[model samples]
Target chain A: MIISVASGKGGTGKTTVATNLAFSIGADVRIMDCDVEEPNAHLFLKPEIEEKSIVFTPVPEIDEEKCTFCKKCAEICRFRAIAVMDQIVLTFPELCHSCGGCVAVCPEDAISEIGRELGIMEKGRVNGIDFAHGKLRIGEAMSPPLIRKVRSSVESDKGQLGEKNVGKINIIDAPPGTSCPVIAAMKGTDFVLMVTEPTPFGLHDLKLAVEAVKLLGIPAGLVINRADIGDDTVKEYARKEKLPVLMEIPFDRKIAEVYSKGELIVEKMPEWKDKFRDLYRQINEIGSVKSASHKEK
Target chain B: MKIAVTSKGPDLESQLDPRFGRAAYIIIVDPETLEFEAIDNSENVNAFKGAGIQAATAVSDKGASVLLTGFCGPNAFKVLDAGKIKVVNDAKGTIKDAVRSFNDGKLSFSDGANVEGHWT
Candidate 1:
């Protein structure tokens, strides 16, 4: 079962929940840090780096020698990446979506694809849990490509990680937001574990995240971090939405100290390990039921 | 020579728009005859990205040799350069006055784009 921990607001503790969950689970669990823009799960997990590979996405490159300024390539480019005006065919490489529509539409066969470096995907292991993350190249505007690369790495390198078990859990620490990167991480996952605080800002963004998850038609639960500090609005919102409050982590200074020092909470406060383990148990129970019902459809 | 001026409205009396990519309208003017055709640029104004590239493509396709605008980004400026279209930046007058400045040689071709790409 794949469980993606996501939050609509930044600093709501997606990495905290995800890393802790992976550290506590005594099963075949692989945690992928899909927050390519700022992957902090590695900071907490501290997985030993075992392998590294560069990730790339294809972008169009026009072959000027093919010589037909037919404007077809430009017309088919939805991103406005290329433009053929008179004798000049201008290509904006950064704007290209790499859909290859321009290459496919070029009757003169003037377009070819070239790889643009998106980021680097690193694979590692902490205890028995396999860990992977993507570090995006600085100044790269888009991150969904790198997020996809991190998720795909798990599938590609599954054999080397461990023997594939039926109950293997892949925990995805999704980027904060309900945008493309978040969707890319949460989509196809068995369950979405939404981490949020109890404040107004948290409630507002949680509504947006829940709206996104509802559209995706996936079963999701909430893990309210700093649960004791904020208002009860998040709890009320969850009740109204019929979303289960799976776990709650109170505002504890010890947890904060461990997090600040780039250490896992399950390692320092051994009691919290059971809490995280229980969180996984709830997810496993809920995820399997959701999947079983999903299959009936 | 034909010049393209980014404008807030379709007519020559309209104010010159400072933005190049998200301009409301592009006025194609003939300085010798004072004849102009207003091209609505709403399509580019709502673009998520590459608005400058699309706007530059429109100007290049319109056969304009000069572009009078308040600001041109690097991407639009590059496209304009490849089309050999001279860009005059920091334009603040009405469309009609901008044409007069172009004619009187008061406005000079900018060395490069005044602003970075993706600027509002």
Candidate 2:
């Protein structure tokens, strides 16, 4: 089962929940951090990555030898990264979106594709939990490709046929947004655990996130962190939306102080283990109900 | 010559695309005469492939003579280079003014690539 842990607000203990949850589940479990821009799961897990690989994206390369300045390639490129004039084709690599439409429309066949490295991915094991994450190169604006690369690495490690790890669970630390990166992280997951604080900003972003999950047709539950500090807006919204309040972790300085010291909450507080385990059970039950309802209909 | 200025539109309409890929359009203006207009690009088939490629494909379709814009990455450059297009980086001011600068040979093409995240 693939369970994606996501939050609409930043610094809301989303990573904390995801990492601790992975440790609680133990064997046959993995934590894939898909937030390529700023991955902090490693700060807590500190997994000694066993394997590493570079991620690349294909972009067009032009050959200026053909000599016909018809400018058809430029006419076809929507990104404006390519411009043809007076038999000269100018390229702006930074502006390219790599859609390959230029190569497809090039009348002179001068366009070719080349790969550009975006970032690196690490695959390893932490406390028996298989780990995979993408570290986007500093200053990289695009995170989807790196996210995709990490996802591909997960499938590859699951085995060549993708059937060997059919029953394993992958808990993903998704980015904090409703953009393409977040969507990419949550796409194929069987369950989504959205962590949010009880504040107004948290509620606002949570609504957007809920909409995204609903649009993706995925089962989701709410984990309200710092439940007591803020008002009951999230609870009110969740109740109105009929979203399950799976678990609530009260706002405590100990949790915050421990987090600052780079300590996993599950390791520090043995009592919370069972809570995460119960959350997992509830998620499984929700999945079963969904499938059962699908079959009945 | 039927010069095309790199606009934000796709195909003939790419001249109107609000932004080229992630960045603004590459103002495809006449370098010799400084006449500026947006260029029309083509449809990006692999819109899901990646944003860089999508932008490159979009701009290259418009038959732009020169890519005059600020901010872009290697992926976009590869597409422009593949089509034998030259890039003029760090271009500022109005699109027309940039074109005039290019026509007057005041816009010197920079060889160095813009490091990602350096844009103001």
Candidate 3:
């Protein structure tokens, strides 16, 4: 089963929950960080790098030689990446969606595609738990493409069996916000583990996230971090929304220190490993129950 | 040569719109005859992105040799530069007055975009 950890607000404990769960799940799981813009799961997991690859996205490039300055290319470009003046045709690669519409519409065949640097994706292992993440290039405007790339990489690697890959549980550490990148990470996952706090801001953003998950038709639960820091509004909300509150981690100084030192809670406390395991069991139980009801319907 | 002025309304006496990309109207005029046509820019004003580029396309398609507006963005400036359409930034007052300044040779073409792109 694929579980994606997400939060609408930034600086929530998505990385913390995802890393701990992967560490506790231990052998039969692979953690993929789909937050291409600022992937922090690797910081705590400290996975040893084994393989790396550079990722790229297609953007339009124009050839002036064989080109008639027909305005057709410009007319067909939805992004306005291609503009044709009387004498010259200009192409703004950054604005291009690489839809190839301009190339398809060009009567003179002047437009062609070239690869633009998206970023780099690295795969590694931490204590037998597989890890992978993508780092978007600085100033890259779009991240959904890279996030999707990371998702596909993990699923594709899972297809090539026989390398002691006895795992089917894929944990996705999604990016913050309900935008394209977050949706890209959460799409196609079996369950969504939403990490949040107990504050009003958390409740507001969690509502937004739950709305998004509802639209995606995915079953999601809550893991309340810093549980005692704020009010009971979040819990009240979870209860009212019929969303299960699976786990709660109190605001503890030692937990913060361990996180700051880039250490895992399952490794440091050792007892919390069992707690994370319990959390997974609860999720599994809820997932099965929900699916059974769907089968009945 | 024709000059295009960004305006808040569809007339020569209309207030000059500061932003070229999201201007309400684009008045294409001939300085000699003072004859003009107001092109409604609602499509660009409502654009989610690339408004400047779309505006530039409209201005160039109108065969305007110069554009008069208070602020122009980089993307529009790129298309205008490619079209060899001179952009005079910081244009203010009524549309007619800005065109008069151009006719009197008092207005100069801007070097580049004056403001960063305003993303919605």
DockQ leader: 1
Model 1 lDDT, residue B77, Cα: 90
lDDT of 3 by residue, B1-120 (tens): 898999999999999999898999999999999999999999888877788888887889899989999999898999998888999998889998998888889988898998886541
Give the per-residue lDDT of model 3 (tens digit) for A1-297.
Answer: 788999898888999999999999887789999888888999999999899998888877778898888789878777778777776778887777667788788888777788988899999998888899999998887788888888887674433544544446789999999987899899877789999999989888999999999999888999999999999999999999899999999999999999999999999999899999999998888877877887799
Model 1 has a DockQ score of: 0.62
* DockQ preference between candidates 1 and 2, better one: 1
Cα miss at B68, model 2 (Å)?
13
Chain A TM-score values for every predicted structure, listed in order: 0.95, 0.93, 0.92
Stretches of candidate 1 above 4 Å error? A156-165
lDDT (0-100) at residue A6 of candidate 3?
Answer: 96
lDDT scores in order: 0.89, 0.74, 0.88
Sort order, TM-score high to low: 1, 3, 2
Model 3, residue pairs in steric clash: none
Error of 2 at A53 (Å): 1.3
What is the per-residue lDDT of model 2 for residues B16-64, given as tens digits with 9 covering 90 to 100? 2223345434444555655545432333323433355455545556666
Which docking band does candidate 3 fall into? medium
